[model samples]
Target: MNDAGPSSSHPRCDQIAVIGAGAWGTALAAAAARAGRNVRLYARRRQTADEINTTRRNDAYLGPLALPDEITAVTAMDDAVRGADAVLLVVPSSAIRETARDLENCVPRNVPVVICAKGVEPGSGLLLCDVVAEEMPDQTIAVLSGPTFADEVAADMPTSVCIASSPVPGEPVGEGTAAQLALALSAGSFRAYVSDDPVGVEIGGAMKNVIAIACGISRGAGFRSNMTAALITRGLAEMTMLATALGGRAETVAGLSGLGDLTLTCSSEQSRNLRFGLQLGAGTSRQEAFGGAPVIVEGVRNAVSVTDLARKHGLSLPICEAVRAIVHDHADIGTTLGDLWAQPLEFESNAHDTTFRHPDANMARERIEELIG
Candidate 1:
């Protein structure tokens, strides 16, 4: 069977409500405006909302640019999403459930909830979509995930993502609002692939941040390309195990949301998540590494969340746990790296466990260090 799915040729919608005002949310708002929708980008902070409407730029995050006349900014949730056809929740994973619960009565019944956020609820092992279902049981839900960097996507760089929605309630994967939302979001440079497995897509998006942090450490430690490659491979193993235990398809992790994003976030200093870890390796304190400005480094919080989730499920996410310990518990970075390097070898590694770290990761350490400076 052909896997790319049918082409997207339909006209885009008239309005979209994008929650949050971070870089990714701002970029998505820009994308939606460009998609011919009268976009309303919401920010929890009134000051940010005022900035977008008055200055025409998300100076705090997206830098300077004229948000299309079709795009407006607002801080009121009811006003922003009440009449919108679809709502994109681009807030952090930690805020997903609370945000959805708050919006439960504000948005229309049929309006789709596009879960632009990624990550499993750390201790609950719940994907963002799952959390939404529990909170907003009747609302249509979809997942948008893949190798998307907010800056690149905001700039309209070539990118792709997986859209998983229940096409039909009783039917199997790939049968839902997920693909339809993707079809509507598609443009010349931004492409969305349809996936039947929301669990796999969400898992890939979450676990990748942990691997990215690990790669950052590898780079800082002067590890070789072979070493990064080995870590990537092993990281993949851990991700697959976590996803499988959580009930996601293994092959799905091999796709764009999985290996694709892992490679992108880990190798490039452009990735905020990886950048955070690189800063830590170079001796920046946790607070100093993040330091007041806004950046969507999912790894920053995911380190703790993932660690908590693993413990709840009785699963071993050693890499993510190590990442959490180093970042939150103030575990020695050198000791954590040493522990990661000392895992017992298993021959005939599980293909599902492949993490996909870039081979030249070690060589990029200097570049990352320079970025931190």
Candidate 2:
């Protein structure tokens, strides 16, 4: 870790180590470099590291986008994190555990590890942060999520994201860590907001991809804007319900990680989940929908995990469940869509008071059961 301690405000993060050299990882390295920090990016392949170092570009991921000289690519994970102030774990959701296990030996106890990948572990239904904690119990942890596109962020386009951190009961990570990380990554065209709700932020990031798939399916099925709008709105309701049930705040779901991410992902074709869903809705087979793309469509895997997570909480997420069926169960898309529309309609709100209120988890579960049953 850097010698600089957390400031009363805006702590210095001069050395940043980013593990994983995928598009998101490379873009984050660019963001950190743009923030005037020395960034060490770790790539699995020697070729990728060599390309970034010699050509000043990660042609495989970012194409011809020029990376700042401040960013250095390394093939070794230990080389990336050694003496770094903070570390960003930018690997895929499925790789979170293995990556964290590998990082456990390299990262310092005091330095915070920011989990940039978004998804629940299909096996354990654990959030990526928890998976990291399980592997690196002594390390401080945080999460970064929001409506971000790797290409746009790499181009230094205006982007805003939320960085959420909360100290575990006996963990070394303090509340100030999240703010410091936000400061470390905030550049001229990139904005980072700090939040204490890591659970909400992570859930929002994961669930949005699944919701975006739902929206894409709607669009690909020839549904108009109204259907997309409905899916987005209802998808948020499902997100809020599951997030709150899992100890996250409903208000957090309304913020950047939740509502903001959901809106951006569902509204754009840049999202891989949406594109995959589009293919499925257009009568492409599941295997064919993937179509040899290198990019992982997180929603395909997350649909199952999210649905299982909801069932574990006794909550029903119709949109996510429908997606899970179509993507994994080999269910007919048209029939699944029809079944979703056939569900019983109920009040959108549980409160009748003067002030508006989102449904609590219990009320949400009850309402969902009524609709589904």
Candidate 3:
């Protein structure tokens, strides 16, 4: 295979540095390469890099799919970030802080780092961007999330994700780094829609994994379709409330990262969280469920974080609470499902609806700045 850059028919795109060699990272690298952008995939292990470079395949993460000729895998962090137009951080949520910290002095100044991983930090309840900001204060950040399975994306299946960046509040995106990177990354059968609500996008992506577990437990425990639908609707309300309290727009949650991802993850057994929950519902121990699995099931970890985030905001999230009980507290899945329904009925709509009375924009902005600082 040839190692040429993107074809000249398209404008010269950025050399995208994808930091992570997991299934999602490899798939995005392949997509960027397919879109005629120069791509570099960074792996922590030299063997992983050698495997991709020598065989043109990331069989460990993505199976037998052939990577694009325009892509190269490197083990060195400097080789990945140096001279790159954009960086895609596709590591798991737990490693995002440390992974980005390594880029502090190496990343090109002003180059945007796109967060491809989804989840809130465990103890701090900070969104991925907030965590990144704390570590790499000068780096520009964007979020890429939605209802995508890595294998499907690698197969060139039709997939759409929301790309969110911190925009000046109330300003329409024109030439922002997020939009530009979105344009470059949109390839055959994969589309990206830009948004300024990184908060909502990140929250939705993180919370949906927890909700997927709830949905799987419902299914494995023999709940009806109406129960599943109820879980989804109520779950969205819970998600919307927490997001709104955190200064994100509710409509953003209704978009690809929110309803779109929730629907896909909850309904599909392909979801790792869902599968884990299914095993739990069938009476398997947590260790047994994950003992032989190759991938990290994010929802199991996100359950604690989501619960903590909701509590931090003084919000009531029954679905998230139940998931936390099941996963962390070792509550019986059946009893937890019962507890969810037994709770006293209240107004379905949230008190601080992002759709209606908005929070003080100035205060929100100031708070965000302080957190980043």
Write down the TM-score of every candidate: 0.84, 0.90, 0.89
lDDT of 2 by residue, 1-373 (tens): 5344455544467999999999999999999999999999999999999999999999988999999999999999989999899999999999999999999987888899999999999979999989999999978899999999999999999999999988556433433788788878887999998888999999999899999999988788777788799999999999988898889999999999999999999988888889988887777877777676566889988999989989998888999999998888888776677667656566776342143344354455454334323
- Indicate whether candidate 2 or candidate 3 has the larger TM-score: 2
lDDT of 1: 0.78
- Report the error of model 2 at residue 94, Å: 0.7
The reply for model 2, stretches above 4 Å from the true place, is 1-11, 167-175, 290-294, 350-373
Q: Which ten residues in a row have the lowest lDDT in candidate 3?
A: 3-12
Q: Which regions of candidate 1 deviate over 4 angstroms?
A: 1-12, 167-175, 290-296, 351-373
Ranking by lDDT: 2, 3, 1
> What TM value does model 2 have?
0.90
- How many clashes in each candidate? 11, 0, 0
Root mean square deviation (Cα) for candidate 1: 5.9
**Cα lDDT, model 1, residue 122:** 67
Write the residue-wise lDDT of candidate 3 on 139-254 in tens digits: 78999999999999988899999999987564335566667777888978989888989999998999999998888777766665887899899889888888888999999999
What shift in Å separates residue 312 of candidate 2 from its native position after superposition?
Answer: 0.5
lDDT of each: 0.78, 0.87, 0.84
